[model samples]
Each structure stands twice: as C-alpha cells, then as structure tokens.
Target chain A: MFQNDAFRALDRQESLRLLAKVPVGRVVYTRQALPAVLPINFSLDTDASVLLRTSPDSDLVRAIDGVVVAFEADEFDAATRSGWSVVVTGRATVVTDPDEHERLSQADPTSWMPLRDPVFVRIESEMVTGRGLRGTRGTQ
Target chain B: MFQNDAFRALDRQESLRLLAKVPVGRVVYTRQALPAVLPINFSLDTDASVLLRTSPDSDLVRAIDGVVVAFEADEFDAATRSGWSVVVTGRATVVTDPDEHERLSQADPTSWMPLRDPVFVRIESEMVTGRGLRGTRGTQ
Candidate 1:
C-alpha cells in the first residue's frame, strides 16, 4: 500500500467482490528485463486463485515462472474523485493441470480484443491488500 | 489512437496534457525478459517531455536501455462514463548530459520514500496517442 496519507484503506470484501466480477485486469510482469503491465483476461476460481490464458509462445507466459507477480483491478469515480482499488501479489506458475485450465478458459479470458487458445498461468496470491481515497478531499 | 468508433485521432498535445493532469501512471519496462509496469511520480516539462527521477542503482534504471517502453495515464469520469487516456511508446535512455540533466532534476523530483542521486531516464517517444471514451456504454 502507498505510504501517503491520501491513500485510504479499502474494504477487502467489497474490493474482492468487485475484482471477481470483472473479467479483465492488468497483469504486471517483467518483460525484456524491465517492468511491464498488460491487460489480461482471467477468471477467479472458487479456490480464490486466478487463471490467465495466454499463448505458449507469448513473452508473458515465458517470463512468469515461480516469480512474484502483481495483478490489479481498479475503478475510480471521477465526479466524486473517490475510488477503490485492489492489488494481489503472489507467485505465478504455469497450470499444467488440464481440467483446471479448461475451466479457467471456458469463455473469453481477455476483455480487450479476441485471441486464440492461450496457455494457462495461475498466480496463487500470497498477499492481498487494497487502498482507496475517501472523504471530501478524495472526491476532489 | 484506437480503431473503435469512440477514439479515432490522437496527437502529442492531447497526450502531453493527459500525461500532466493525471497523478498516477505506469512505467513499462523489460525485466528478466518480460514487461513489467510500476507506478511512480512524474512531472511534465513544457517541451512536451515527461520527467522521471529515480535512484541511480535501482533495477529499474539498469533494465531500461534498448527497450520499447510504454508510459500510460488515464482517468475515468464515472458520471459521464467518459475519460481520456494518453500513452507514449518509445525507447528509454539514461540521460547522461549533465547540464540538461540538472535542469530536469531541478523540478523538485523528491519522492515520499528515500531515493538518492535521482538519475534521470528520458523516454524519447516514437508515438504519442490518446483515446477518449465519452458518451460510451461498455467499460473503457
């Protein structure tokens, strides 16, 4: 979480529910030896783990192996200038289990544009935290 | 610029403006042969250049050379369901010119947390584009 006083503590339940509802999120990974963030289509299974469908030859699939990755989804209310966001940090591993992979990619795994069958990468979150800006000043 | 109906044309002016107005943006880079995104403090200079000052020895600095980096900032107005975003795609190079470097670093590049020397990385943009989602229905 941000050290600034402006960042408010977000409600875990509400934020998690919102995150689960959304079909897409930004997957932060390391690309070409630098930090990169890309939009990913994923599903939050009953076990609270995330499933990402990506091509086996894709850079994202190759980069994330037993690495600590961050996945985030956020919504900000501009009129009120207040919003809540949730971030999940965990270890990312390629899901070799066929049955689990099928269930995760049952539908559109990505929200932006269409794609072919993507290799499934699962990020098992170790830490889940959220922050928000609330009150009058937050709406500014 | 987006191919969709909402956002058709984008230019440098709009991109620089949006880049300046937004408080948060993702700095894309390559790390461990993957793309990763990190949010950091940035200031816009009058010459349409974005300024970033980071610690000289950090992994972020070491990993930014010869890579196609993308820096993006956007704000969504929930009331109108509309907002504008600007993204700059270019290669990032470490600024070695002392006199020019001093001018940018002078713009108050201190961070909330401890970071020393403030090495500057200039993202020479190859393309500046923006997209506006106004009077829209689906997610931006």
Candidate 2:
C-alpha cells in the first residue's frame, strides 16, 4: 500500500469538514501529568466548536474543564492501508449559559455509557490540522 | 445502548490482548508543549511492547523518541453503542540494536506512507488500562 499511496496534508477547512462528519472521536487531555485519551460522542457546532455530552460528575468533565485538550477522529482501511485523520487542539469549557446550553443540548450528543444529567462541554478550536492518504476510500 | 449495558474495566492482560489484535492504533505525545495524536500502523511483541515503523526523519519519530507517549486502540459499534478501548502509556525508544531490530523488522509493520528507509521504534509499556461496554463485537 505504501508503494501505491501517498500521504497529503489536508488544509484547515478540509480538516474541520471531515471532523464535522464524524459522530465519535477521542479527546486527549492531561491526567496526573500524563496524557490520557477517551472516546466520546460529539457534534460540531456551526462556529466549528466541538461539543460533547457526558455525565455531570464524570472524570472527563472534571479533568477537561477549563483545560487545553486535543480532539481527534479518523477513518482507515487495513486491507488497502489507507486512511485520514484530523486533530483539533483547544481549551475545553463546560457550557454554562442557560440559553446556549439549551441550544447545544438540543444537538443531543449520544453517549455509549448511561449519562444521567448529561453535562455539555465545548472545545473552542484554536488549531486544526489533518493528513490523508490519497486514492483510498473508507468510512472514518 | 447505555441504558442496557454497563462499562467494565479490563485487566492489563486483557488490554494487551486487545492491543495485539488491532493492526492500527493512535499514538499521543506532547509536541511543542501541546498534545498531538497520530494514527500509525503497529505490532505488539511478546513482552507487550508496541512497535511501529516510520521514516527516520518523520516528526513522530523525532517527537516521540525518549518521550513518554500514549498509545490507544478501540473498536466501537455506532448502532449498538458498544466497544472496547485500550491505552498504553510508556516511553518510546528507537530500536538501534541490530539483532533486535532485525527480529522486529520481520514482524512486518506495514506503513501507508512511502518509507524508503523505515525506522523501528518501541514503546516499553509502563502502564496499561482499558474499558469496554458489554455485549458487542467489532474490529476497530
């Protein structure tokens, strides 16, 4: 596969577009001075911010609030050895404004684990970058 | 799906088993003081160390060498909202020993990007943890 395909850097716009298409992604944050990643369901808002829903008292909510975090999503094919990945780095803020929270709540980010009293958090993207292998097709 | 199934933490042995099953996983490391995540092809050795092949000059090779890095892999089903994820945190070192390098090279970690001179790196596992949502099966 390396003989036939080449990796290309995706522009910022293209990266964000790909990010918006995926409902599941991994959020990387510092935990005990070590980087930790967790998969979460998310939605991309109109302004390009990444929104996620979790339990009010979950570790993700506590560890990520008001801290810089990285969000990543990708699609790859093992058979063809081709895929694309997008990464976003920014500060994650728990949604607190009543009106804005209500609006985002309507987006309904689904959680695989039972989320009683779901709390919404938004990561305002400060930098976005992505890379893709050309001439490949796969669900990301 | 969360309503029906509960998340269970997997033991270290089980986590390593899952990691070995997947051919591709994401490596997370600090780049310029910011956390960055990249998807790469990998193979797990008998000692539970993660091995990857990349260009000697690749940013991943440079940024991760001698650094504490996090490797993550998962399988999730969107419809059933079930999957498992394993994370290994360890220090990455470029394999320089000829004998060990030759043996690892035989493992055949395929790269999607053209690698004229592939460099092998090993992540010596310092910590391993995993979690799973019960009652689903998929390769991720």
- Report the C-alpha lDDT of model 2 over A1-140, residue by residue, as the tens digit: 34224778899899998887776899998888888899887888888888888777777889999998999999887777677899999999999898998887676655555655677899988899898877443221
| lDDT value, residue B85 of candidate 2 | 92
Q: Candidate 2: give the clashing pairs.
A: none
Native A-B interface contacts kept, per candidate? 0.12, 0.37
Q: What is the lDDT of candidate 2?
A: 0.82
What lDDT score goes with residue A106 in model 2?
70
Estimate the TM-score of every prediction. Answer: 0.59, 0.90
Cα-lDDT of candidate 1: 0.64
- What DockQ values do the models have? 0.15, 0.37
lDDT of 1 by residue, A1-140 (tens): 12245556656565677778665567776666545565555777666667776667667777887787878766655455455567777889987788866666664343342234556788875666677655224210
Tens digits of per-residue lDDT for model 1, B24-113: 566766567544565555666665656666667767778875566877676655455456667777777777899988777666444433
Pick out the ten consecutive residues of candidate 1 chain A with the lowest summed lDDT. Answer: A107-116
Least lDDT summed over 10 consecutive residues: which range in candidate 2 chain B?
A: B131-140
